[model samples]
Target: MKKSSLILASAGALLLMAGVYLAFFVAPDTVVRIDDRELVQFSQKIFYFHVPVAETSFVFLVLGGLFGAMFLGTRKRSYEQMSYAAVEVGFIFVLLVMITGVLWTRAAWNVWWEWEPRLTTFLVLTLMYSGYFVLRSSVQEESAKARFGAIFSIIAAVNVPLTFVAGRLDSLKPVHPKVFTLQGASMEGPMLAAFLVSMFGMLLFATSLYIMRLDLLRAREDIEYLKEELEVG
Candidate 1:
């Protein structure tokens, strides 16, 4: 592993651990009243991790698209590698978002799934990105594969913002909880602090993964090139 990536990974892991500790122990539990009874929602603690992962996924996906645009403009293999790596890392976080979301939903809504606007839009986003890998593999030529993949990455990244705002759209009337608004975050001091720590941790962790994956892709390409040269010799 690269020194930079190693440092990022270690820092991210420590911050995430601290965030978890703060979320479970330092932050106050959400108390809701139902039928004259006060209930402490323990599952609400998942918010620190869930929201951070979801936002980190957005950041990576947007970076993938930006790198894709750069690759297209410059025709650089490095940018193409970066685009692919970011998307791969982003997709893993997307899956994590879905799994954590499902658990959150089950805890809050008493159901495994819901066809709410936010959830539905995110699911579509997931399916769209899944096709990115399929599109890459279907192409035979290397340049063509890269070009197509870049285009798909850009398109998929466009969906990220739409998915984010789906919950706020008046037409959608989404059931998903909204934590942030034009005013500010809906959470208190300690809760917000924990969430911020988790968010930064997740972003750093995702970036480290992207760098590692990009290095691996470059290594694989080098190996392939060496094999070709040896055969030619």
Candidate 2:
């Protein structure tokens, strides 16, 4: 591993820890009054991580789509590998988002799952990328597999915006709120600070993970090439 990557990973870890601490101890507690009763839901803290992970996942999914397009255009194995790595990372983060989302839903809405627009579309997005891996594996030829994966990824990215807006547009009330905005009064200062720190931390962590995974994949490809050369010799 490169020293720079290690440093970056460490920084990410530290920032995440700080964000967690601030979320738990420093951010103002949210108290919602229901029927003249004040309800303090600490589960709201999940927002710090959940929203960040979701945003990160979307960003990486877009990167995967872009790299996939590049691979299709240039027929470069490097771009293909990059696209795969980005999708893999995005999938993992999306899973994290799902888990946290479920927890938040249970806490806020008293349901483990719902057939709401956002959740449904998000699940579809997950399945689409999951199918990308399946399609890649089912094919025997490397060139053919890469081509299919690239095309599939590009097509799947069409759902990104839809998934993002589904909750906002749903008539059936969703537990997920549209908290993100440019308006200065939307969130408290400490809460915003914690959210921003968590986001930056997750971005750094995702970048480090992508670089490390790409390097590992490249190493495996090199080893396979060497083995083939030896056999040919």
Best by TM-score: 1
Compared to the true structure, candidate 2 yields what TM-score? 0.90
Model 2, span 106-170: residue lDDT tens: 87677898766656767778788889899999999988998898888888887678766765675
Please give me the total number of clashing residue pairs in predicted model 1. 0
Among all windows of 10 consecutive residues in model 2, the one with the lowest summed lDDT is 174-183
Task: Please report, in order, the local distance difference test score of every candidate based on alpha carbons.
Answer: 0.86, 0.84
Candidate 2: lDDT of 22? 90
| lDDT at position 152, candidate 1 | 89
Q: Please give, for residues 96-121, the per-residue lDDT of candidate 1 as tens digits.
A: 88899888878878889977665666
Model 1: residues >4 Å from true position, as ranges?
A: 163-185
- Give me the overall lDDT of model 2: 0.84
RMSD of each: 2.6, 2.8
Q: Highest lDDT: which candidate?
A: 1
Q: Candidate 1 at 145: error in angstroms?
A: 0.5
